[model samples]
Target: MQSFRTELENPIVERDIIELEQKIRLFREGKIPDEKFRSLRLARGVYGQRQPGVQMVRIKLPYGKMTLAQWKRISDISDEFSTGNLHLTTRQDIQVHFVSLDRTPELWSQLEQDDITIREACGNTVRNITASDAAGIDPDEPFDVTPYADAAFRYFLRNPICQDMGRKFKMSFSSSDKDTAFAYMHDVGVIPKIQLIDGKEVRGFKVMIAGGLGAQPQLAKVAFEFLPADQLIPYIESVLRVFDRHGERSSRHKARMKFLVQKIGMEAFEELVKEEFTAVKNKVVPIDADAWIATEPSETPGALPAYTIENPQQFEQWKKTNVFEQKQAGFFGAYVRVLLGNISSDISRLLIEKLQPVIADDVRVTVNQGLLLKFIRGEHLAYVYSQLEAVGLAAPGFNSVADITACPGTDTCNLGISSSTGIAVALEQVIQEEYPGLIYNTDIKIKISGCMNSCGQHGMANIGFHGSSMKSKGKVLPALQVLLGGGTMGNGAGRVADKVLKVPSKRGPDVLRSVLNDYATNLQEGELFNDYYDRRGERYFYDLLKPLADLTTLQDEDFIDWGQANDFATAIGVGECAGVVIDLIATLLYEAEEKLLLATESITAGAYADAIYHAYSCFVQSAKALLLDDGVSCNTQISIINDFEKHFEETRRFPVSNFKDMVLEINKQEPSAAFAEQYFQQAKEFYKASQQYRANKTAQTVNA
Candidate 1:
């Protein structure tokens, strides 16, 4: 077998991990080196990085729960292949890394053998479903959230409709009060909150819609009060159906569910979902969890014994910081801080190897993206903590502010928008040096997403940043969109940082400095950034730092250019069906949109084409319902070859139909006075209508 890289050079596994392992194999055989690997991948995917060697593979594990054997398999694989590091991502899956290109396919196959798959783990597809890892384990949970998560994953995975979404779709499942999972950052967040109805407790999820992170971030809107668990799958499918059918597909930047829900208004969107869910209601399946749970392997080698320790101070601190009483009495859950959640190559091996002998055979990862050693007797606490510390895994602050999480940004990701690891390191340093009390007094979490794709979940951070292109003078440059006021959409989830500023990649440190300084100076007592944004709208603080966003914003004293500058020149969007070589489409239908210019340009023609433009726009609006009725498949693209043809026959008066655009090479016989007069008339009328609409909207806003 060929060896992969020796930690000196590596590749990001964003788009997928297959090609990466192939390169590593060839290199180990001395057939290819650095340049070859770069050229091999430079084409098919987005490339970014952290430092240079330690690469991060952000795997998609939607709904967060996996089989016990799957967990053990990954744990063992991490030891044998990677640097023995496993990171539980906020999106509800674990990420392992440091395995060179050589071991990638092996790791993938190992996962595959267990009937687990990871396609689109890194790509633009809907990432892993995120559900509270403690769903079945937490007593406070309304029901086992795993089945709903599982059904959603199966129904949507690789569905055509979800393939080319305007942007990614995120969903979450939580049962407890620990919204620490950042469920609010998702496109859809589901939490079980018991409400009294007729003095009886019923299980239902408070459905949250629209909330997401990227250049623009917004808290989710509550869409439904109580959606029964049985209908959860259908309800979620309906939500995606609305998004898939109505979401904007043109601008890559504006393609998130949050944008769609915001533009249409929550009530209207909910009605649309109800209409769509009605279509798939019969296909829904109810999960019988007890039957499945009965199959779980019996607890390995009996239970761990409880021991009373002599050191009350240390025990008390550990109990306070490490343990929690589970829904099952005397069975407490605790998180083991792995210090930035990093593990060594050797430590990973021993962790899985010795776990059977230590705690009970069963172990589960937490939504906090950390390994959760559950069912540990009080006696095992000392031994586990000691061993974890021996490997530098004992970084204090189990939920303390210092337990900041960061995804691998440009440091090791090919598609990374920023240096996530680097920013995390710097941010932690500043926190430790500047404010020690905040770490203990309040729970502060700083999460960073390298790109808008949300590998790091920066959108839900107490403070967050999405990778962006900071262009000037018509060019591309590195920048980060600061997202704020996103957290768990449920009672347990905390609000993340709201976007207060968009700063250049290099200037992020300084910009954060300014924001922090302001936060410290102006914060209300006991107010976090989330509270500040809540009390005062996001704009109130962002407007304060307008100077940072202005073109005149100067670089800092430590400014230095890094990577290639963004291009601001002309651009083109390339896709299938270029010039339909039917000698190209018979004629161009340039999307048949109703831009203002089109309306004005049409009237210049002799009333014939002018009437057509108005008729076409009306036809489109009328047909909107039918167009979105069929429900596009979630994993593929929808090609409507005859949609335009049918529209053409019905709206025969229009100049263009059937996705066909028109170009008029008019040989004007003198500047026709008739056309000129009619053109101005239309423009004036359009202007008047636009002005009235704007005024009405402004008045409504002011009143609200």
Candidate 2:
């Protein structure tokens, strides 16, 4: 590994890269524990993949907007360090997989040269803050939500409060009531709204909270029908504070904000959020839209070049499906559909070169894993189409059924059970070849995930499939859990797709054909897929597709998974979305000491809430370490306090009084300087005593 001491312009970012390099070096030298190193690397966007000795680097694209320069920079980085493929995610970020982990710091530094980032793109922190790709250009939008989304992304990027939370948090912003961003299915969903008060128009947001999709999907509750735009940041900060303190940490599945809100009703959650108001540093965060206003590129083609369309009908189809008339008169938003969200680095640079003439400088990444090119002239539509077609990116049906959304399942992800990409390709071919007319149908979305985790946003798809497997005669076979009747209901309401049935993965195309054929033959006029599904119910679809799931008709090739040469086998690896568990007592004690130091530093910086939380972590980690010494393994922080009270505090084996009360004091007391200092003292005393007690126990064990 090489040093990045002076390579980066931003000293802060340079230090971050350098620190990552140091950590990776330490991890390689066997100095740091695996679990601890995994957490650190994940926060920096270095993710371990299903394949050993390679990593997936997720690049955080705030609001999914990136300049041409940044895109080219990413392309260059991918070409040099990764597999020369850029995978756009459903969250509007770009991921490059199969990269050497030791080279990540260099890659991150190179990306930073063009103002791109990967920090906080993964792990137990706020993921990329996504918004409607057509935000500024949407004709139906009340106002652009880009500035507000950017504000949230900037505020929390390095905020101490969210550095190491119980689980990853997600947020989204929709430009209009159409809910193009699918704000209803996020941890914090905000839809832009305008309220007239005494003849004056005031900007606000319809806020939703605690919505998430995993193996289990939950809809977000309306936090406020109309929260003033200025209060958005403060409200989010408070909600995060509440979630960090009270959210589940033991079970990864139940650690999302959705579970916390479900466990405790919305009313109770709101009360807890209200309690965090005083601790939040900002009462109101005003967004200046002018600061982030879209502007044309400084250098553009002086004259439009003459071009002839070789395929006139295809170009027209591309325009019909891929082009959208922007709010600006005569301007258009062109969607470039990259199949499976995988674009080669060579094609990516060509796009930057070709589209520079007519398109605006602002290129937004659509949530459906496509590119949104803004500010194209009406006459230039055919030209843009030509340029894109030449580069093999002029695929019609940008958000239509043909453009299937999928994750890199077995290709790169650790949690993938089957080949999501392979299945997606087959389904897309089904739509393109058989159901050609459906290319213009944006109502039906087909999304796939390699696993039950909704990274591909399968839960929100009208027709969704997640990778799985089945057993027949002692052989494992690739399977997909088919889901139906779920999609955006508009106005911040959405449906989670119901798992209808499971079928062999190779039958994915057949499954689609059956569903579409059934819809085409038996559908009523003017009814959407969800309505049809509701009218018929789950059993109707199950019985209709039941014959496809028959194992008796299976062939020898059925045992083989997609995109593989060998027979199917469940090769699932431990997921690292949430950090791995560390059973080493020494690591816990070291982390506790580190937290205490962080608390002291935070107090000096006047971040009272941060300091208090650090102190709280110190207490919990130290106590948990001591409890582990007694063979009392606990999962959650709350449980650790309880068990410590029973096993140590009650027996008078450890020097403590009212253990629960002592640990829980963090929430009851105000986050003031005095309290922060006092909490720091308490945590220090507890850590010291716990270490001494552990030493005494070790001595006794040795004597015995």
Candidate 3:
């Protein structure tokens, strides 16, 4: 039998590696002149991701969690070797993408001092052990499951069972019910669940195995609902062992564990896994987790200082869209949106420098495709905001209806189907206009990818589009296949998105416009877009898209009006910074339970008329400003509360009307019926707390 070391000295790691090693050996032996090391390093995938003159080698941190020095060494690596643009990937790993390859061995040697290795970063292996992005932060968590996530990562990091698997594997820790780590799309997903012996909460996790999606998607099956968290490592090891031995080897595409799980029934898979777990359970020591993730992050030095904003209207809007509530008190979390996650060399350097001044000594990269600038001083948030804005990084559209995630396509790779970045921009622009008010008050995530590789995670959005090519006028043109009703993390039960139909790259905006238009026309008074699409079924969307999807022509006039022929920026990671105003409004419209909520109400005949009056007044002031700014002034009836009365004789106690009635019912309805009324209300409360968020932005702008 071949030893594991021998198995690695082969060609799968790219043919060039072997050649380079041979050259180095010959150089050492004086067979080849010793002056060739510099040229050799640059050609071996050792250079930086970008930065023409500077080379930053991306040492992969497979899982996001690392030892204190491994974390600090990365900080040191960047400080010592090259520009410090270290990043955390959506795959739940760290990427120091700009480094000098000539310093490669030195980088590894330094990491080795801290016991870190980057060998499994880019090639085929179980890359990272992902977990809830807020694994320890969400207060509503059933348990802090980071320990298990860390355990799995360490147990599998360099295991022979994981290396050179038939296809890449993704395992996740769903510590909370939210499943935001996207466990449903991973090869294995672990979620904490309490087991009761006598009504006592015993520690265990509900293990789901083999859930994945790409060209083919399958949700994991439950293998165990209550296995002790300590048992996780061995159990997962068992599953991987089975897969490594039994997974399909003949076909690369069918080799994923998801297919293997399907090939064998759930019961059989569990039986096999149990046998494997029992075999290895005694070989390892009980891992001590206290040294890893201890608890939720607390406020620390170097964070944005807090300021008291009296009324941050614009900042309120931005916070409502971008900032998220942390489990911590008197402190909040901000998702530093990195505009398609592209960090320029200058910006990368700026990120490290600017953040170091305000954030705590520790900085964390998030898998949400963003950065987590942790531990801000309660009073300095405004200062950080000001600094970020000064750097041309302020955005009002953080998770707005237009906040989009897209995969890098065509320009960088060969498999991309469409310009996902271009489509994302166009979609955002159109929706922001047509549904301005509706979009402002709620959170909707929209993700896109240039191909079915699922890099932008199109399978997780409320509304998502994947790149596809369709024959147009006898020429294949970039197009998209729309996927609807997909969301995870603290939301609904995960659902595999149903593909509607193909929309040409040019006509993508139109298809999106048609859907939103139908939404505006048909939504059940207060329904969010996903529920509306899910309840209506695919037939409704198909019928609505019929006209636009049919207009695919190679002539280019019928598709995208803003582009210069086949080039659209919708490919993954193409860097879509602006141009969002027009595209979104041009897509889908409402058609059912369809009634636009009166931005202002005219109720005056109620006991709570004072409260109703306050609502009415605020609504009117807000609407007048909103509609006027929206360029909707041409529609006179857009303001139904123009004559709102201070008199208490006509309105009901809950003076709002049901916005979901298709008959346009004026019957008094509670605001509780619309858009997860409770959630929207909660978001409003969060926004209200964003008093500091708004003040900080103002202070930021003033300082700038």
Candidate 4:
């Protein structure tokens, strides 16, 4: 543990690692409550796995971009700490499983050597900021969104505002109107736009807000047709502040930003966001596009690399499906379809070794859990293919019907009910062997999640399935809730897949064969899959595929789940997806004191806006701590403020008369240094008073 302390270059990062190590030690000694410790570790990207006593450390890669050295460093870290297998996620993060909890700070320290991070990759804080893998190189893009995404990632990485929100926040930057990044399903989705103002072409963004995918999927509403690029960060900050203050907290299921927007209409949400503009650190945070340097090919354009095509047909197919012409002429963008997004450390190392010379250093982990290599010279396409093929990284049909996306269901996730990976592998086998030509078909997409949480983005897939279980003749069997008619409509609009039917997990292959065969046999020319499904209607597909759901026709093997050797039984553990909810009064006061410390630190650093927000958090946490001690339920920060007045102030238990007015000043006034200082003092006084009151009550109890 001391090794990482001296090795880390950044003082803040060093302190963070040290804190985590200390927290882990305290947790082992039962000094920190389980729920409180869970929340702290989750924000730092250390997650509890389905298998107890091990962790899954998610490495946050902003927009999935990683340099060659960073990629190699991750592989080395995986070899040393985990199972030597890197699991890429749908959110463009790489996760390594089965790591010892005690060794996580060391693992994170090693990753930081190459400028990599695991911070905020999971939990209630802002997860990894994702963008289209082709963001910079896409021909359809208005401008490169790489810098903007980078800016957002940097601004919010350890920002005080979103540290402990009711639920996690997600943001995405799409490359084009095609919405390759799935902006429509993120909390804050940004699509670049160019508007003419005073005969000048000015950069802007088409902003969407409060969209998310889970059991209940909501498409983000268009907040602005064109907001000046300079105002993007401020707008996002305002939204975060509003959400932190008023978002639902008591119910984990309804704690998402989308739910907050749904509870209070979009118009109201927008008004709240506008009200917080004064409190935002920057009124206009301009993004310098030129600051983000595009990765250039290291090799000078010269003679083509010597390579003999062993099979020209295979090479041609690979080229057609995996290669695309980038906006930069004479350079190609290549995709490598990592089956189930699981690539071994050895293969990853080999991939870097073989492709480093020919390709640019920029490698993007795609949103669909694949890899995108930018700036590949046309002359070296065959050589690139040869190298990838040799390493088993040359699977074709990247982002096509054949390239199925699936999450690790029963494999590692605690919330997993059935085997998403097993079913995905089975379905991919069906596509490759039976519907081989579907690799060229990009209209239809197949995604599967372990549960309805949509980690695999199943809610937006053209053909999606989420893991479930079905009862047949009093026996339980793994099932998949088949969903249909969902696809991106482009330009911040998309459809949520309708729950069509449920069938046995063993019938998953048959389900796909039926759907694809039926579509292929009776398809209209140039008709997309969703359009075809729409024309046929939901009932039509249900009737066509319902035969597989018949319990009477179930075979002996149907009782078993995919990738399992024995009979199926549901085994689920407590999910730490959003971290745990801590209701202990002692923990709340401790956290409130911690918030005051943060507020003081922010004041010292001259970050007035951050200090004010931290102070505001202190006020809320202090109020909530006292309110909970009185058996009052505190769901939202806003509710906590109101409930404190009702329970403590009204009853004359606490002396403060206008607690609401005092705390609401955060949104009422600009975050000036003077105001920040005043707010910090008020918050510190409130926290101290609450502590004394609690101490008096404890003394009275002892006397009684």
Candidate 5:
């Protein structure tokens, strides 16, 4: 555990790395609780894998855009610190597994050298900000959304207001009305829009809020048909403020922003957001689109060496499915389908070495676990395809039905129940061999997750499966929970997949064959798969696939899971996807003190709004600690505030008078320097008093 302090240039990032090192030391020494350490490390992108004593380091790439150098840097880091493999995630980040926990700080320092980060890649914070991979190059886009997404990412990264929320927040930018980024499934999804204002064109966004995908998926409500671009960050900030204060806390399942909106109507949520507007740091933070430099090729294009095409038909197919003409004239965008989003470091290095001359410096990792190469010259497509083909990266059907999306599942994730990656590989083989023509079909999407948490985005897939299990005749077997009829409806609208049935994992390929065959047989002219499913109904698909679910037809092979050699058994570890519940009073008090320290730091930095929010968190944390000690369940921060008043303030057990109003003053007044100072003092006084009260009670008990 060597220090990374002197190796980093940026003081802030250096401090962050040093803090991680210190925390890791403390955690190993048993000074910090497991749950608290888990939350801290998760926020820094060090995730606990199913395998003991190793971590998965997720490198956050905002909007999935990375320079060739950054890509190479990650590959090198993978070779040095991980398994020499990189796993691209559905949120547009890259993950490397089997890393030693002690080496994380050094690994993170290396990543930051190229301006890459792992911060907020996991845990209860603002995760990666993803956008349409074709954001800048899409012809259908009203305007390029890359800059706006970048601005949002920068504004929220390490921002105090969202540092510790009830759950993670996701934001996306759809380049066009096609909704390629699936805006309807994000916490704050935006689609670029242009409006004529006073005879001039003005940039804006179609805003959608409170949407999420999991076991209980919800489509976002339209917050605004068109909100001016300048107001985007402020509006999002206000929403986060409201969510942090009033969102569910005790129950991890109900902690998302979508649940908050559901618990309180969207209209009321909007009112809460409005109440936070005054407290937000910026009322109208404008995004400077022109300041964002558009990506271009790093080298001059040289004449391609004459090469013979071994398979002209295959090359033609690749062109049709994987290549598209970009909005930039005479240039194109090509997608390289990375199977299961896993690429070896050797192949990655070769990709950079070979494609550097043919493509732009900007490489965008797609949401479907693939890579998007931008600004390819028309004459270079053949060479690019040849290079990709040489490296075994030339796969057709970039985002088509053949391109299946899946999580690591049992391979690494603690929550994985069955083998998602194995089943995905099997399903993809089935699609490529039997349904070759389906490669051109983009309407049908197939996704898989190890569990129903939707890490693989299975909740909104046209045809989806999540890992499960079934017991038959006293033996347990791996199973797949089938879901259908979910897909994007365009313009911040989508439908959640309906759980159809469950079948043995070995029959996963059969499930795909049956569904596609039925779809092909019963297809009407000019009908989408989902529309046809709706026309036929859920019961129709259930009955059609019902025969496969019959346990009596199962064999010994069905008892084993995919990509496994032995008998199947459920071996789920405690999931760290949302961190863990910390009910320990001492831990809560420590966090309160930490928040107060953060408040002082923010005040010194002249961030009054951030200071006020930190102070507010301190107040809530201290109150919740006392309430939990009194055997009160604090489900939400608002509940904690109200209950504290009921149990302590009214009873004169706590010194604070009108605890609710005292804390509620955060929203009632603007975040001025004076108000921020006053809030910090009040929070400091409350924490100290709470600490003294606890000390006295403990002394009395010990004496007795």
Candidate 6:
């Protein structure tokens, strides 16, 4: 570990790893609180798994791009630290399970040798920034969005503004209006656009904000029809500033940015963002598209291997489903459909070693948990196909109905209720064996999650299922909440699937068959799945599949969950998707002091919006601490403000005209230099008074 510390070139990253090591030691020594330690580790990408004493490490891959060397490095790390299996997640990140918590720093240090990162991959920070797998090679793209997505990830990787926010923030970049990256379902979604400005073409983005998916899904609203690409970073920064200050904190369910937009309409959110612009350092930070371009290789393919297809039928099917022609002339893009997003380390190594000659260096991890190999010449397609098939990776379905998306349900997730992976495999088998014709139908997307947090993005699937349970005859059985009529409508628009019915997990295959059979029998020609769903509505499908939901028809096998040996038990562990809450008064005050120091730093940096938000947080933390001392507990930030006004302001214990007005002024005032300084001063004074008041009150109590 010390040797790794010396090898790191970046001083800040070195300090980060060292700090994690120190925190881990403190936590083990019982010096740090469990909740605080959890928060710290989660931010560092060490997640608690269902099994005791093991961690699930999420490796953040910016836009899911990985070179052969980086992939090999991860494979090696997985073999050393975890089971020799790599799991791809819906967020375009890779995860490995059952790792010792103490060894994460060492693993991270090793990954960083290849410029790979795991920081902010989990917890209430900005997760991985994803983009279209076809961003650089998409034919319909106005321009490639890879550099912009890369820039956003780079800017926010260790940025102080979002390090300890109320909840996680998700962002995506779509290559074009087709929205392959599902921009409509992110905190901030951007689609590249070219506008004719004064007889010249100008590159910009169509920006959408505050979209999210969970039990409650909200499609993003358009923030700008065309925001200049140069102003992208500043606009996002201002939005983050507003979210950090005013977003819900105490309630984990409502902590997402979408709820913030819901509480204060989109117009109000926009106004708050406008108020923050004056504080941003660079209003127009231009993006250089050429900074990282996939230029054609100087040394082209030497010779094509003479490969004979073993299964001509399967190879042709593979060509139809998995192969894509890139925007680059004569070059092709190909996909490797990893079943259930699980690839063995040996297979991953084979992909790196065997596919070297035929495939290009540019490899992208697709959102559907598959690998996208770019820049394959037409002549090498057969060779590449043969090599992929040799490695048992040449599955024909790429984002097709046969390719099912699922989370690692009871396999490792703490929050998993039923077997998402097991049911996913069964459903895919049904698609392959029973409804082979639907493989060509890419309109209907099927996604499944272990639980309703939508880690599998079940909320946005045309046909989706999430792990659940039901009671019948005084016995609990694994169940799935069947969702239908949800999918991307393109151009920052989508639908959240309605939970139509619940059935035994074993009946999951029957549900897919019933839905597809109905659609196949009663659909009009050229009509899409969503249109058919809208025409038939939820009740029609409910009636069609209601028989399967009958509890009386349960069999003994239904008691056991998929991929499990024993009868089901609804044992849901605490989900650390949102960082654990910390409410101790001393801890709160310590945090307040730290926040004040951050505020002072932001003010020094001329990041006025950031400074204002930090000051706002400082005030809130101080107020909450004192309020807690007074035995007044509030759930939300806004409620805390109002409660403080009622108890402290009205009682004349706090010297403020109105507490709510003072704290909520973050959204009201422009983030100008003068206002920011004045507001920060008021916050500082308030914090000082709160501390003194608490101290004096404690002294009086002691004296009595």
Estimate every model's Cα lDDT from 0 to 1: 0.54, 0.88, 0.54, 0.91, 0.92, 0.87
Model 5 CA lDDT for position 439? 88
Q: Give the candidate order by descending lDDT.
A: 5, 4, 2, 6, 3, 1
Model 3, 566-655: lDDT tens per residue? 334333331211011111111101100011121112122221212222232223223223223334431111122331221111343222
Across residues 165-264, which tens digit of lDDT does each residue of candidate 4 receive? 9999999999899998888999999899999999999999999989999988999999999999999999999999999999999999999999999998
Which pairs of residues collide in candidate 6? none
Which prediction has the highest lDDT against the true structure?
Answer: 5
lDDT of 2 by residue, 580-655 (tens): 6566898989889989988888899898877888888888888889878778876666678888899988999888
lDDT of 5 at 294: 82
For model 6, what is the alpha-carbon lDDT of residue 120?
97
Tens digits of per-residue lDDT, candidate 6, 623-700, equal 889889898875656667888889999999877777788777776666777877888898889888888888889999
| Runs with alpha carbons beyond 4 Å of true place in candidate 6 | 1-6, 295-298, 303-308, 596-616, 634-692
> Which of 1 and 4 is ahead in TM-score?
4
Q: Which prediction has more favorable TM-score, 1 or 6? A: 6
Error of 5 at 267 (Å): 1.4
Residue-pair clashes per candidate? 54, 0, 81, 0, 0, 0
Report the C-alpha lDDT of model 5 over 565-655, residue by residue, as the tens digit: 9999999999887776779999999999999999999999999998999999999899888888889998888899999999999998878
Question: What TM-score would candidate 4 get against the native?
Answer: 0.98
